[model samples]
Target: MALISDNDPIYELLDKWHEDDEYEKILEKVDEIPMEERSNKLWFRKISALNNLKRYDEAREEIAKLSPRCTETADIGRLFYMMGYIYDQKNCEFKAIECYRRRAEIDPSWDECDEWVNDSLGYAKKDMDRAYNAFSRFFPDYAEKNQNAAEKKTVEEPDILPYISAMGSSFMSSNLGVKLPLDQPFFKCSEEDKPKVVSFLTDRMHITDLKSLQQDFGRNRLAPLTSNILHIIETGEEPPLDKLNAQQLTHYEASKLLLGKMKEFIPEGGLAAWDYSDMLAIARFMYSVDMLTNTEIMQTYLFANDECKRLFKSWEEFTHSLTIGAFYNAFTRDTSYNINQSAKFAINVGLFCMQTYPGIEWLGEIKE
Candidate 1:
């Protein structure tokens, strides 16, 4: 058989085989690769295959050969640790302990072997629970709540569950190409501003490409002057604008000043936790660019289309507003990557809220 290297198509096929748990095919791919190009990763895969098939002796022999040859200290440490697991599984307690100690000595940070060392004789109920409930990391707080519920111990819940739930729901809707409910408080805009926000999003600012973005907002629209103003707003300091002549005020500067002026008209608490200029910047960026096409995706907006028209007041206008501006506030407020996973996270938040506040019917309306 002709020997192949890492660049060969066989690697992809081997990856597929590994994913499918086809241990035999994995060994076959390993065999096809030349010995010179067969890195420690491939060798580990081969050992893993042997162990999966219960060929303990063969696995040990291969590990023995590979151990001395491994140049990377990390590889040697992991290799010995895995070998320890194999021995432990085989009921060779002494041999497993020896391997575990050797691995620890080689790599001081490899504390995972301590689990085996502490419970070498057998795992306790706590260890079993930890292993079984490894997925608790996804919903850290809720997982704790669930554990408390199981223990019949009451756990104090958080107050901002509705906001978290809404955020999570919106996030999921974004990924699944589904639109969130438009009637949510996060999307509260006046009837007069509705048409303007919708038109700005669907027609004027519905940017799908770089060309359109640059065309609508010039390439240097977010100039240093705008940055200066943003810095002042952020730091609560007045900039020395009088030093600059009228001719020095560029379009970007004027736009930023207008944004600052617009802040004065915003209703009390309407722009809670966010300045008008900041929201304006977010809105401009979101409406003027499509995240899927942009190389650097800062935010992903959940767009509303005809399918979800019934959920809105003026279906067409509300649909566009929901797609364009409504989410700008929420996505900007949320520190999550996007609305999908955030929305999924809301499931736990909503549940936690319901448990804490038993009678609030509106809090449970996170789905709508």
Candidate 2:
């Protein structure tokens, strides 16, 4: 085989730690290796990934591959312990306790094995009680099966899906701008006469009557992110730049109004998403909403690259009219987790304005 690249020394260090008793470090090293061909040390790497990623079955398959000629004095009891840890951490108490027993059986003389088996059994017993008490899917195996499904989807295509979309973490949190009830309740406000609520500032921080505190949190409007985007595409109402203060926007970057997208009216067709992206060129003038940089870059040169343009078009089609999803797709860092940004708010505001404005069609209802 060709001599391992200059990166071999790094991999060699990782290989040394791969089977070390430090389970967390072993996982770190496993992650350090690229996912493409982890099979070289695939056995241990898979073990570390599965245990941490909560794929117990796959981890077991990898552990099986790590076995030697036979279970001798060299007894891989430590590996068994890790398996137990994985199961127990996921609250599969019975399986965890069973694995612990198997580990102790393999190495009757090993002190670590004894301690591990005891500690794991303790956790298993407690979790078993709690599992009976609350009786919920807390032990969902913490299975990242949904994320794995998304990963599988992206691997099958050159057009990788944005991480936020795959993770289903829409970007609705970031745009609301200011805090409400941030002091006493950490952004929660209570009305003594009103009922309990799950989320405060349900859509945007608004002053509605406390009587409106129904189970729905009265979030009758589009998500802030969505409304904001619609606002941008339609009305061009930007965050008040005067609010940014003096130093933030200076002589070099003068305080100016937030620019909106310019759309051409096609008479019969109404308005089409302008293929020309002047929004990006006038980035300085346009409100730099969260993830605006990414969207700007994406929109700027996307059409120039044949593959990228096609992928974008496909994404646009997939997210057509679902402006919320599309804007979130680009604003998010990774789809696997929810983003706290509100870039979609501008889009929502834009679209809302467009629908309500003169000569614009209303496909959906606007509140009375």
Candidate 3:
């Protein structure tokens, strides 16, 4: 809405296309506008037409293309809502719920978004419960026994349980019940080769020093840069571009472009979740490389686990926050990053974990 004007003739044409069910004509009209010139309304119309025509893949492609271009909160929120609809139609219930949850966070007044989220969540819960019940039928006391144990385990070593979903995409790809493997060949190195394994794992996870990474979580290095960009988005007051060097200008512009979507989707405790996830991920790699002993690794996981429990209420909420953090991490580090692909990958990982590991308490319980 912030991006459209009633006087725009293209919108008038789009409305006529909608009325006549001329979805193809809507696409054609939208395509006629140059990419740079296309407004949010144009992108919305194009995606709507694609959806109506049952071209879900093309609709998703268009959504991915439009994601990075959105600058207004209303536009970003609507984009997520549209994405939710597409996923709902495709029967990807978890992904749809994730998108709807994001839309709700961005614009809480859109009460319908909350309804969609609850509906999808309700359906997902029934499916998961059915699966659990089927499994329990084979082992009559399994659910009751494990449910109690899981609750007790949560209070004792909260880190291990919470870190399961943070396993993210890697956990999804492995055999369901198996512990996630480290880089396989390196995982079996001789004691003399331990240093090589350590070096390799550290480089792979981009971890320079484990202790430093843990301590640096409190640092707000991006605060000033983010504040400047937020100011630009809120008030049309532009900072002098000529004063910034080439790299600074690039970061400034990229932050300006991404800040809107970031603010809309990044939930409460999102940044902390991201940091803790990274720490746990790196700790796993460290354990494999002999950089951390079993005791050290458990200590790391426990600390992160406690923080995550304090910050997020459930596995879905945690993963959603983690994805937002991943998006910010990707784009901020490399302006050319494909955030759309990153988001899809992250969501898929969360969905797989939820479906595969239904016994995990965090996945089952909906804590307030």
lDDT of 2 at 364: 17
Better of 1 and 2 by TM-score: 1
Predicted structure with the largest lDDT when compared to the true one: 3
Return the top candidate by TM-score. Answer: 3
TM-score of each: 0.31, 0.26, 0.43
Q: Candidate 3 local accuracy as lDDT?
A: 0.58
lDDT for model 1 comes to: 0.44
Let me know the TM-score candidate 1 reaches against the reference structure. 0.31
Instruction: Put down candidate 3 lDDT per residue, 1-368, tens digits, no spaces.
Output: 14445468878888988999999999998787777677777788899999999999899899898888888888898998888788667654556666766776677777896688667655544543443333224222333444544333232344344344345325422422224343331233356655654555555444555575465444523334455566678798987887764345545554555555456444455455556655565555566556666677667766666666776765545655665555455545532333344444445544444444444445233234
Alpha-carbon RMSD, each predicted model: 25.5, 24.6, 14.1
**Error in Å for residue 160 of model 2:** 58
Question: Which sequence of candidate numbers ranks them by lDDT, best first?
Answer: 3, 1, 2
Stretches of candidate 3 exceeding 4 Å from the true structure:
1-156, 159-196, 202-242, 357-368
lDDT (CA) per prediction: 0.44, 0.35, 0.58
Model 2 C-alpha lDDT per residue in residues 1-368, reported as the tens digit of each score: 23235454655665666455455666666666564535433444547656766677777776765665235543466676666677666544334545555665667676674576467546544533332222122112112232233322221121222211211112232332222211111122234312222222323323222223222222422233333444555665655556542223221111011111111101111111221121111221111222124544344333322322332332222222233232333323122111112233424433432232212111211122
In order, how many clashes per candidate?
Answer: 7, 34, 0
